[model samples]
Target: MNDPDRARPETPPGHRGVQYAGRALCWSLAGGMTTAAVDIVLAPGFHAWPVLWPLPWYLTCVSAVAWAVLRAREKAAALRLAADEDLVQGQDWERAA
Candidate 1:
């Protein structure tokens, strides 16, 4: 009964924070986009649309930035994990010698 993950190192606290932040950002952006869509659809006419026009653009930019940040954090965590695994394996080899 070999559990593969037993030897893996735990993720850093900051990694979890990044994940949580990304989730929050995604949900908030989704809510904003949904609200914006409803507002645009139910508006009286084009005359009153200017106020709600920039919501999509703003949300898009923010979403892009958040996506990039999350991706970067994920990559960093993966690299760290790989390094830790290598270190652990090296120690095991040394002990076997």
Candidate 2:
């Protein structure tokens, strides 16, 4: 059977503003921390990154980048959902974008 809730107009989450702000803060801080940790472990050759860095450092950096990338992907998915909701409810797309 079709779901009745599907036809209802969507409302923005009550905490949407704070939730997105928190996500942005966390994303930037985590990305910076990852790069900084790699710089610490790689010592003088961090500028060269995975190229000149030792195997362990390279692996760690790779993992950090992967984590950040995945977080970004999740953020994009969240934004997409918000945008979809906004479209359904006749809201402006600016915030969701």
Which candidate achieves the best lDDT against the true structure? 1
For residues 11-77, what per-residue lDDT tens digits would candidate 1 score against the true structure?
A: 6536765676667667767767776787777764667566666565576567668767877877888
lDDT of 1: 0.69
Candidate 1, which segments miss by more than 4 Å at Cα?
A: 1-9, 44-49
Per-candidate alpha-carbon RMSD to the true structure: 5.1, 11.4
Tell me, by TM-score, which candidate is best: 1
Which residue pairs clash in candidate 2? none
lDDT of 2: 0.57
lDDT of 2 at 77: 66
Give lDDT per model, in order: 0.69, 0.57
Listed in order, each prediction's TM-score against the native is 0.54, 0.37
Q: Give the Cα error of residue 2 in candidate 1, in Å.
A: 15
**Each prediction's number of clashing residue pairs:** 0, 0
Instruction: Give candidate 2's total backbone clashes.
Output: 0
